[model samples]
Target: MRLEELISQFQKKDKKAFGKLYEMYAVNICGVINTIVRNEARAEEICHDVFIKVWDNADRYDPSKGRFFTWILNIARNAAIDELRSKSHKREKLNLSTDFFVGILERPEEDDKRDFDSTRLKKMLGKLKKKCIELIEMLYFRGYTQQDASEVLQIPVGTVKTRNRNCISQLRKNMSAS
Candidate 1:
């Protein structure tokens, strides 16, 4: 069934449709949270919270505003970012190294066991250049704007958009392949 159909069913409080939607997006949502929190357990907790938020705010979602993935991506990112800003997260003094999400991708053993369809993502991400990874991390994961990414990466502002487009294209290819 189409995502819109599933969403309609979900709006009607259909448990089966909700479960299917959850199954489809849960891992990706968790991945987004993990990219921000950099802790598997905390990311999982945040993922649950994001789902709850989505359920509570289901009436607010409008298809004309954006893609369903984009909507949920924003929710997950906002939730994860909020978690980072919380008092406990601040007090913990977590070291957000330069690599951030890249560090997670590079951890062969742990990334293998934790992330869903790890091998596929590893292979897809492996095809991307280091700069592509960095740009995607900054722009998508870290919520940096084009200007911020360009300044941080020392690239021209014009390059940031194209670079991000290319990076997402690679991700799309990987998603299709998997």
Candidate 2:
């Protein structure tokens, strides 16, 4: 069957149609998810969740918005980003035993007393908002795809590119100023 016909059957909750769709797209979707999450096992779990999400929200898929592939590709990215956020939050909670602000502020000083470059990077990054820093970290330092960063930041992909361009511009300006 054609993709639209399969999707139509899927929307009507046809099990075999859904299976066929899964068979066709599951690998690609998992690959997209894996690009963000980086763990094959976790990517597999999140990929399964994305399909579940697709099944649950089948009625919401409007072809005028885009193709079925794009729709599910989006769903997969969203699930992967959510998984990243959840993992980050869990790590934060697990590491929350700092001695309030005093230790939080002093531990770095004690640990990196000789690292002037680290200090300079912190000073330079101080001008950027926490959001922009997170964006940079997610996109560059953490090896996220542009699509993954866009979904994680809840911004359009075009906006992510523009903001990244502007951020890089400012970073160069700051580095040159020092």
Candidate 3:
């Protein structure tokens, strides 16, 4: 069944539908959170909270508003952004630089973790150019707009879209190969 069908059933309190939705989106949701939070455990916690928010706000969803994935992405991003703005995060920021998601790839312990399967992710990323990775990390993972990424990366604005599209295509190919 389609995601919209499942969502409709879920709105009626169908457990099976809800379970299917969870299973389908859990990894994606976690990945989105991890991109923002940069901590696996905290990302997992936020992932759960995001789903709960989605469930509780089911009635508020409007098909005309946007794609379901886009909606959930907004919720997950907002939650992760909120966490970053919290008091505890403020304390942690005093000691560490506010690096983006690509920095996580360089963490030795995180790279070795089986739960995150960082090795596989690294291999997939290996297929992409360094510039592609940077562009993707800035635009998608760190939530930078095209204008923002262009300014930060010192590239043309049009380059941001083309570069991001190419990067995502490379990622899709890598995923298919894996």
Candidate 4:
């Protein structure tokens, strides 16, 4: 049977159609969840939960918005994010959206518990000027693409690469001087 036929049957709550869809896409969905959650068991659980949610919200899905697989991909990604957020809420109370960079830069207290290399990393980071440090931090530490850094810093994207090269050169010069 065609994918559209399977999806049509699934939306109508046909158990066999859902089963066939699960057999076809379970691994892919789990893989997507695993990339975000970094745990196989958790990924599998999320995969199952996501399908349940998909079934529950079947009426809301519109083919005009996206393909069936794309819709499922979004659902899987969102479920993985929710799982991570729930786990984070249980462990500690911190707003990751706002504090991601600040948390990386500061310890906040002596007793604060985190497995991050802040002290030695801070010293190494001290070698660069503020802009160079920010750029390097965004690119390497925070995983910002050149285009992202450019937009955030209000500089041309082309300048990001040039400045990054110069920043590394400065870092090398500072290291040799020390």
The per-prediction tally of clashing pairs is: 0, 0, 0, 0
**Candidate 3 vs. truth: CA RMSD?**
3.4
Highest lDDT: which candidate? 1
Tell me how far candidate 1 lies from the true structure as C-alpha RMSD in angstroms: 3.4
Q: Quote model 4's TM-score.
A: 0.52
Indicate whether candidate 1 or candidate 2 has the larger TM-score. Answer: 1
Clashing pairs in 3: none
lDDT of 4: 0.73
Task: Please provide the root mean square deviation of candidate 4 (C-alpha atoms, Å).
Answer: 11.8
Model 3 over residues 1-178: C-alpha lDDT tens digits? 9888998898887879988988988899888788777789899999999999988988888888888777788888788888888847675543222354355466777446655566777778868877787787666555677998898779899988888898999999998898
**1-178 per-residue lDDT for model 2 (tens digits):** 9988999999998989999999999997886676567678998999988999999999999988899987898778677767777775665532211122222233566565652235665656656655566666566434467898888779999999899988777767777777
CA lDDT of every candidate: 0.79, 0.73, 0.78, 0.73
* Alpha-carbon RMSD, each predicted model: 3.4, 12.4, 3.4, 11.8
Compose the digit string of candidate 4's lDDT tens values, residues 6-114: 8989999898998998888888788667656767888888888999998898878898898887788778877877777788577665222323333445556453445
Lowest lDDT 10-residue stretch of candidate 4: 94-103
- TM-score, per-candidate, Cα-based: 0.79, 0.52, 0.79, 0.52
Candidate 1, residue 123: the lDDT equals: 72
Q: Which ranges in model 4 have alpha carbons more than 4 Å from their true place?
A: 89-178
Q: Candidate 2: where are CA atoms >4 Å away?
A: 89-178
Q: Any idea what lDDT model 2 has?
A: 0.73
